[model samples]
Target chain A: MLELHQISKHYQPGGQLIEALKPISLTIKAGEYLAITGTSGSGKSTLMNILGLLDLPSRGDYLLDGVAISSMNDQQLSQIRSEKIGFVFQSFHLLNHKTALENVMLPQTFGTVPLSDIRQRATHLLQQVGLAERIQHKPAELSGGQRQRVAIARALMNQPKVLLADEPTGNLDSQTTLEVMALLEALNQQGQTLILVTHEPEIARRARRCLVLRDGEVVSDHLQRCTDPTQF
Target chain B: MTAQAKFYYLHNHLRSCLNELRSHALRSMLTTLGIVIAVAGVISIVAITEGMNHSLVKNFSQLGTETMMVRQNIFKAMNNDVLQPMTEREWFALQNLQTGISAVAAFSRVELPGTGVSGVRISYAGRSQIGRLLATSANLPQMTGRYPIDGRYFADSDSDARRRVCLVSEELAATLNLQLGANKPLLQIGNFQLQVIGIMPGGNRDILGTSADVYLPLGFAMQLNPKDIALEFGFRSLDESNTEHIKRQVNQLLRQIQGTRPNETANFVIENATELKQFQTDTLGTIRTVLLLVIAISLIVGCIGIMNVMLASVSERTREIGLLRAIGASQSYIQSLVLTEAAILTTVGALAGILLGLGIATIIAAGIPQIEQVILPPAAVVLTVCCAILVGIACGALPARKAALLSPITALNLE
Candidate 1:
């Protein structure tokens, strides 16, 4: 349910032109899991930022659910981000001062949901991610795996249609990484669209389809089926 | 937004800040130091002014509500320090005037040494108490707005017939160990027996402090002390209006009677209670101005301190503001949040200062006997609160603007 038509993004530093994303075109249907794999400086992160509506394209048309978002103001873009897209960062960007439950409830603040219901839903999501006992613990008190779980629960708080995880398990150990992958796979199997950016081949193999990007352009788009999606 | 929602938001934000403040209680107290000092200074000055105003009103009221004084003045051509005396003819002319003249009386002094005139004896209580006897007309009670409480005063016939009747003050009676009442026997002063009519209550004993006074008939005083050339005349007017006119006319008539030129300076001066009241008002005004200046300086210092603290707080909360914005908080929300914190701090400080100031004033007023009571003027209280609110808004402006202008991405990048 996302489309990008000839999107081009550039940056200038010290009067030198630097291309972050070259002209590119892509489309993803509803309820499909996709992976954008690339090395450092390959523009995958920049594409993810543009896809999430966190940044605007220098020149392009971004149609999200069939509405052109390039003409939307910052406020309208933010509203769409809050209502339609959930983001999971590699660093797990949970507010250091807030408990796991509060971090998960952060996105719900923009909606009309009652605080008590938000708390209950956040508690339930944390329990689903095997963090029921650690829901009240702040990020500083949690392990690497537990912090990522809190981020994942937070990304699902508003029940967004698309879950965008930018290297969600990049900082976790292999076993914790497998658990995070399994959690994401289970959500995707339930018909929620998932898009992840990663450089790890084994991690990329877990997605239903993998798209390789290099030098600010997509080099390949291939479909993959793992022997066991729950294992690394 | 609904009021309840707004209240919930504000309450949570304030509670969070308060918890932080409680964690650093000593620092918070230090931050509030400027506010406390300013409030205390304001209170003290206001209290002093209130106390002075109270005392002034009391003294004036004691002088009587509808009392005015009239006296003769000599015309001065170049020098203003000339003194002049009024003649008997001029005094009679004033007494006959139909304008605001209430009662007219002339005064002369006499000294009597040793022994009692009637039943009351004479004794010296202090140096000034001895050889100070006032000889005035029988209408002295009406002119001075004072009357005997225990014994009779001299009658008009006593002055007309030049009788040697006299009245003694409570201090003189007490010194002689005599009881003074309406039926009490006449007091003896210098071999003259004067009947005791009444006793006058001494209101401010320290100011009109001593009570050792004696009153006698003016004509009898003239007869007893013929060579005493220093004679002072007093005129009591009906009210405040005709006092100036009566004074001018009396001065002119006195100049004509004494055969002095209009341009020539008089040898006597005219004085009144009005001059004393004016002096009191000027003194009060000067004191109020000085106090207001001090309060203003303190308030400025307090405002500066508030601004400094708010700026520091804004800088510290930059990342938190960014996080809120990233989570969908509007820019106005961030601005309002910072402004709310500022308003809360300043309002609390100001309220604390007002209470502190009033407390100090009450304590000082309680300790001083002359003050009677200390009252805060409504206008002063209103002004103080308004100044405090304005200071809060002014101090919050820069920090609030900075918070509102911060970009969400840049703010999130703040470490």
Candidate 2:
């Protein structure tokens, strides 16, 4: 479970204080698939960064599995992020020089996993992302969809508690986007908690819960049933 | 992680460092050039220094280790108000000393009557050459460990009888086209004709050097120049083990004869073969230190080059740093990774430098026949490698710190 009690974020650029995210309360139970939808300057990216533990909230407390994230030191925060959060970025962010399997094993390189088990788990995750045969292929050699799958495999390498996808298909073709979305849906159906941030309403509608934001304020928070039965 | 696991990760860090270099081969090679030159210079200098030391020891062994030279301390006499010259009186005092010496001889550089040039002119068989004239006693053969390769050395009878017999070096004999033994020719030395009795060994490689081309009986030469008072004394100890005792006894006798008071320093100096070798070794050590200083400067320049390249690498790989951080890498891990890259760069350079240095040393040794062997001192090699690695680590600190302190979000957002 994740809880954000009136969490807000602001930044100062050349003396002007701009609020990137307003104080907004939110909660999501385990295995919940939530999508945050917003247009440009809508603070969705800021909220996703805060949720991923990449940025700290300026006001309010964030609790993940009953541990206060705001009071933790940088090292402790990194440990929590490594163990509890996995991120799929718009750019994939896979090391281009590394093979798909190496990219997947990157997360565990800094963890306590034994060397032999690291390779085994990375291979299994890569296979689950439908990249079994392409494990040795580098990022440049793989298609956009394959690279994103490698990123997803890497994010799941440590068996993180929550998966955060921020416009994960932004650089992919529509066909590849559908494939990635279906993979996400499948993972969600398997009781994996997923958080997706996208401006596309169609993409947002596929999630079990939708939260829309405008001008740094949350405009709507509701649960929805997907129209596509295949993605259920 | 456990200690063993951390060690394994260090291996991974080195592997990644090497991989990074492999990807940017040209840049890495350029960055390491300074280190290569510095290590090569260091190695070659040490090799040559070792070779010279080996040669010095060999030359000392070839000469008599028991031989000791007694002469006026020129630097000390210069500072004193009255310059005390070592004359025959001091020589007589040394001869009467109770130390166990094998032979005692007095020598001086004699100037011919009309030849004022430093060396005396000698003509034999119509070939004329300038020869250095040495006036030494019959004990010269025992003191120098050098005997005539072709005739007999002067005898005490020759000195007692005041005969004008002289010895010519084998080098001068060959140049003058003179035959030795029964039909030996006489050398002309400034209005006096002396019979050449012996031909000593030639070649300047001797410890005392083959600078003296001609030698005459000391008493006979002194009688010819009775006014020349600055004479040097030399003696051979009974054995190599007795040389130090003989030196001390001789020093005490000379100080007493010269009337040097109890608190005053000795005006004369007594030198044995060991002290001479140590002086040469110390001079070589000074040269080695100077050479190492130059190489150290080059190493510092190399370090700066490595630092510059690492900074560029950090800047170029900002996003990579963020990605690693996001995955789970600690800041210390990132710092160590960058440092490993620099270390690998310098290590490669040092290895290449060692090969090049040995090659250069071998070439130099081959060119110079005096150098007995090309020596690769293990300590110097180890020191060079250590120096290079330390330079890498020193230069990597700033750039590594810069990379480690970068915000992961800001770094990941860089396009």
Candidate 3:
């Protein structure tokens, strides 16, 4: 579960304040599948950054399970990032020097997780993501679709409650995109909190609910019908 | 808190370091060269100096830790300079039941008659040779704490009755071609016949197989070569540690007995091999310090080179650092990654250098016959290695700090 109370972001260019996001409040309960769609300057990234606890909101507070995120220190924020929140980047941000299994096991290396259990857990996660046969392949060796699957497995390393995806299929071809979207759809249906930020309308329609942002504010927040957009 | 957990963390970080090192092996080796030279220099210097110290200490101790030789400044006495040897009255008090002194003997040397610098000549049957005569008291060997090699030393009766007896070094006996083991072989020295009572052991191995100087009773020697000279008093202490105390006491006695002014240096000089060894040690210490200074400077320069390489490595991996931070690694963890990598590099260099240094030291020791043995003290080796690692850690600190402060947002915003 997550809550944003009057959260906004702004950047200072020399002397004047440039508003990247206007004040807004929102909440998403556990297991909610939501998509945030916006143009380039629609504050989608700004909002996602606030939601993921990567960047602090300029004003007001962000709450995750009734706890204020802005009040905690950097170390605690990192702990939450590792434990409760999983991020899927558009670039599939897998370290090139590591194998598929090693990338999946990266998160636990920072914590008190025992080394003996890391391999087994990572292997199971890789298998769950349908990457059982390619667990040893590095990012350079993997196909676009397989690399995205590995990224998804890595995000789930700590069994994060909320999956934050920023344009998760932006770099993939149409075929790879369909497979990745299906995987995310199946995960959301299984009650994983999936918040996807994207620009594609058809991709956004796959979620149970969709929100469209114009300028820096959310303009639409409604349930997506199966016929809302033509399926790929 | 648990041993397993601590071991796991150590293993993880060390492996990470090794992995990173493997990725940049050439750079690591280049960076490691400095520490290598430093360790090698230190090890070789320590080994050589320690070896020299070992031999010198043995030589000085062999002179008998308890023995003290008092004479007119022997070096100055040779140059016909100042100071005169003890008189009968002065020698009487020292030899008569002195507290710290176990035994006292007076010895002196004089030119052989008509031989000049060719040295004292002696004959035995058909054999004849030139050698120096060491005129000493009957208890000379006992006072000096070195017994004769084959036969008995001159007895007190030999000195009292002024009997003609001699102790020849093994080399001298060989040169004389006389079977000393036979019934009292006689050696004719300066128109008088002397029985070879003892054969002194072969000392000064460089000249061991050749003829050496012969020892004779002081009274007999005085009668045979009557050249007026001073008496050189040699005494042994009851215990080894009492040499210095006894020497100090003897100095006061000599000053009083010779009736010298308090402002004047003693007419007699006390010669102790330990003192010479100590002086040599002090001089060696200074040389060692200078050598260490050179070693330290080299190590620092090498450390700087390593630091420079680490800084370059940190900047090169800025993007990876940001990604690591984003993934959940703390600033401290990121710092350790850089520091550990640097540490691993220098530690490897140090080990290589130690091996190199030991090899060089062993080769050097083999080349020098005077060095009895060369060994690297274990404590010194351990300390050298530890110092190298600490230097590596110090060099890594700034780069690690710079890396740790990198912001995670840079992963996306900056290449």
Candidate 4:
């Protein structure tokens, strides 16, 4: 489980104070499929960044699995991120120079795993994501959906309990988006907690819970069936 | 982390660094140019310096290590201070001492009395060229191993009688068609004429030099101008091991003959060929030190150049660095990645520079060669490359630190 107690982000450009995220408290239980939907500049990206531990909150506290994140140093934060959190960006942020298998093996490079095991596990993850035949393709060589699939495989390389995806299907065509969403849903069904950041209502309708944010504040937090949110 | 995990991490970092270079080959080459030039400079300078040392040692070998050059006012040669000259009687007394020395020659440099021309003119069958005049004793060949190889040396009788006869080395003989035991054998030195009784067989190569030489007796040299002939003595011992003893004996005899008080510093200097060789070696060593300092400075500049490029590379890869941070790469990992890239660039440059420098050195050595051929010492090449690697690490440090210090969010937002 992940928990936030009134976590908010503030920054200043030159001398003007800007509140990017307002004080809000929230929590998500284990194995929950959560969608955070917001328009442009609705602080959804900022919230995802804080959830992934990419940035520290200007105020408030964050705890994951009952361990306080506010007091950890950068290196300790990195260890926790590697061991407990997985991040998937909208651009599919796979290193352009590496092949699919190499990208999948990257997270383990920073871990305490032996090389031989990392290789085997990377190969198995690619297979689990239906990319066994495309393991050698670089990002440029793969289709949009295939690249997103590789990113998903790489994210699952360390087997993190919490997966944070910021618009995983944002760059794909509609048909490929369905395939990527299906893969994500399958991983969620297997009990990995999934947190998706998107602005599309149709995509948010598939989540077990939806949180709509506006003007740096959470406007709505409600549970929904797999297909009920389009009727909102 | 465990050692195995560290190795695994290093392996991946090395692979990615190499991949980064492969993707941007031209930029890598440009960044490494300074290292290439630096390594090449060091290697070639060392090669030539080593080559010159070999030739000087060879020359010293031919000089015969036991040989000594005795000169007055040698220590104060830079000044015009007057010294007590060795009289003819004193030279004979030192030569008769039955000391460690086997052969010795006292030479006097003189010009023709009326004409100021330093060399004498010889005309045989209308072939006229200026030849050097050396006033020497009969043991000319034994003193320095430069003797007449073709004809004959000066006999003691010729020096005793103060004969107006002279011997010409073959190097001078070829110019005038001079011969031994000819019906007509005479050359003109100014208005005074002398008969050429013998031809001296000459060595093609001499330690100092082999030139057109006309040998005259000491009596004949005194006949030119006894007052102005600057005198210098040279001697060689049968046993090189007893040179110090011979030098002491010569000094004592000279002091007794010149009548200097016991406590006064002797004005003459005795320099042996081995000592000269050591001096040459020391001089060359000094030159090598100075050159190495200059090369080290240039290499430092090369290091700074690499640092500048590393800074540029780190700033350019901001987004990638952030991604690595987000993916849980530690600060040390990012730092190592940057350093690894710099090290790879410098290694490639240094290797290429070694080849280029050695190739150029080989061409130079081939063009100008000594009796003993020379090549670069392998240890120097190895050390230079190791120095390059060290410089490369220093060059990458600042940039790697800068990259490691960037906040993951700030870096990810950098365009």
Global lDDT of each candidate: 0.71, 0.82, 0.79, 0.79
What order do you get sorting by DockQ, best first? Answer: 4, 3, 2, 1
Candidate 4, residue B277: the lDDT equals 71
**In candidate 1, residue B337 scores what lDDT?**
62
Query: 1 or 4, which is superior by TM-score?
Result: 4
**Model 1 bad stretches (over 4 Å):** A108-114, A223-232, B1-286, B367-370, B377-390
CAPRI verdict (incorrect, acceptable, medium, high) for model 4: acceptable
RMSD of each candidate?
Answer: 11.0, 10.0, 10.5, 10.1
- Answer with 2 or 4, whichever has the higher DockQ: 4
Model 4: CA > 4 A from native: A225-232, B54-275, B351-356, B368-383
* Number of backbone-clashing residue pairs for each candidate, in the order shown: 21, 0, 0, 5
Please give the TM-score of chain B in predicted model 4: 0.55
Consecutive 10-residue window with the lowest summed lDDT within model 2 chain A: A223-232
Model 2 TM: 0.69
Write model 3 residue lDDT over B1-415, tens digit each, in one string: 5887777777777766787788788888999999999999999989988877876766565566666767665555566666656655677778874677866777766556565454667888888877666677777666645687778988878977898788887766787776666689889877778888888875222100112367777677666655554677767777777677888888888788888889866678786666656766887798889999999999999999999999998888877777677667777888888888888888889999999998889888765545656768999889988988899899999999999888777655564
Q: CAPRI verdict on model 2?
A: acceptable
- What ranking of all candidate models by TM-score puts the best one first? 2, 4, 3, 1
Candidate 2 chain B has its poorest 10 consecutive residues by lDDT at B202-211
lDDT, residue A71, candidate 4? 90
Which residues of candidate 3, in runs, are more than 4 Å off?
A225-232, B1-10, B64-275
In terms of lDDT, which candidate is strongest?
2
